[model samples]
Target: RPGKEPEVDLPYYHPRAPSAEVEMTAYVLLAALKTEPAPSQEELSFSSLIAKWISSQQNPNGGFSSTQDTVVALQALSQYGAVTYAKSGAASKVTLRSGGEFQQDFQVDATNRLLLQRVPLPQVPGEYSTEVSGEGCVYLQTSLRYNVQPMQEDAPFTLHVSTIPETCADSKAHKVFDIGINVSYTGERNGSNMVIVDVKMLSGFIPLKSSVRKLERHPIIERTELSTNHVLVYLEK
Candidate 1:
C-alpha cells in the first residue's frame, strides 16, 4: 500500500494487545528484505521507506535500538545503498544557519558521498536550521555531549562496582583479583531492557574465562562473552 497512487497503511493490529510473535516477525521481515532484490519500482519504493525508518531508529552512537537489531538492520540497509547508487550525477547543497548570522554550506555528490564533512558551530547556545535542496541522500550527524549528575534515588539505573583484595592488603595474592558488580533497575517500567556491560581489561591483563563462566551461571545474567580486550556481559530484564 505504501507506493500506491492513494496510499494506505498496513494494519499492524493484532487480536491481543501485544505479543512476542509479532515482534519476532520484524526480524523475519528484515532478513527477507536483506535478501530481497527490489527489481520493481513498487518494491524499491517500499524498501526505501523501510530503510529510512531503520535509519531513524539509530541511536546517537549510530546504532539501532539494540545490538542484534543494529547488526541486522545495517546489513540490510548497506545492500539498499548499493542498489540505489546515484546514476544521474545529482548534488545536494546542505546549508546550516543560525539566527541569520552564522552560516555554512556543504556540497554532497556521488564523489564525496562517503566522506565525512564536519562543520564546527561557533555559538554554544544557538538556534539553528538546515536546508537541503538537492537529490541524493545526505546523512548529517551532530555531536554535543555533556555530563549530568542525577540524584541518587532519581537515577533510573544504579551500579555499584568493587574489587576484592584491596591494593594495600596483598603483594603475592595480587596475581588474581575478583570484581564485584551490583546493578539495580529503578525505572517506571517493570524492568529495563537488555543491558550490555563492557569491561576493558587493563594493559597486560586479561579476564580469566573461568571467572566469566561463573558470571554466566548467575540467575540474573543472560550471557557473558570474552573478546580480545573486553569482557561483555548481557542482562535480560
Candidate 2:
C-alpha cells in the first residue's frame, strides 16, 4: 500500500519540560501559517496563548535548560516573531520592569519585525511585568493544510516459503511445524522500502513464533489477531 502524508496537531503539553513543548507548539504553528490558506479567530487566540506560554517558560538566563531545548525554543521564538508578532511600521516601544528596580525599553518597527527581541529576566525572587502599547499586538492566525495519498495498486513481489524439519515428527494430529518465510524485493530506487504480509490459518492449523529472522531489514509483527485467525508482518528495507 502507498503511504500518506498527514499533518498532525501539536500537543499543548508533553512529557518533557514545558519549554520543549512550547518550542514544538511554536514550530507547528509556524508551519501551519506557512502551508495553510486561512485560519480562524479561535486558532489565532489559541496560538497567541501558546506564544505567551512559551514566553512564560523563559528562564532567568534567557534560554531553556538543555542545549537541544534551548536551540529549539530560540528557533521557535524567532519564527513566532517573524510570522506572528511582527511590529507595525510606526515606531513602538516595549517595556520590561522587575521588582521596581530594573527597567528597560526596546524600540521596534516594521523594518525589524522579523528580528527576535530578547529581554533577560533577573533571577531575583520578585515580581516582573512587561507592557507593550503599540500599533500592533502579538497575535496572528494560521491554518494547517495537508493531504493524504491514496493507496496504490500492489505490484508483483517475490516470496519464498519453506517448512523446517521437512515433515511433522510426532503424531499428525498434534505435530507442529516451523515455517520460514523469505521475501525478496528487486525493485529499483533504494532497492526496497516496506512490505506487509498477511498469513491466514485454517481451522485446524496453528502458527508459532519459535524462530523468526530477516536478511535485508528487520521484521515487525504488527498484528496477531488470534480471534480472527490472521497474522500481519511488516518488513522494512
**Highest TM-score against the true fold, candidate:** 1
Runs of candidate 1 exceeding 4 Å displacement: 1-37, 153-237
- Every model's TM-score: 0.49, 0.35
RMSD of each: 13.1, 19.0
Residue pairs in collision within model 1: none
Give the clash count for each candidate: 0, 0
Per-residue lDDT of 225 in model 1? 89
Give candidate 1's whole-model lDDT.
Answer: 0.71
Tell me the lDDT of candidate 2: 0.58
In model 2, the worst 10-residue window by lDDT is 137-146
Give a tens-digit lDDT track for model 2, residues 27-103. Answer: 76666445356556666666667667666666645676567767776776666565654334666678778876799
- Give residue 8's error in model 1 in angstroms: 34
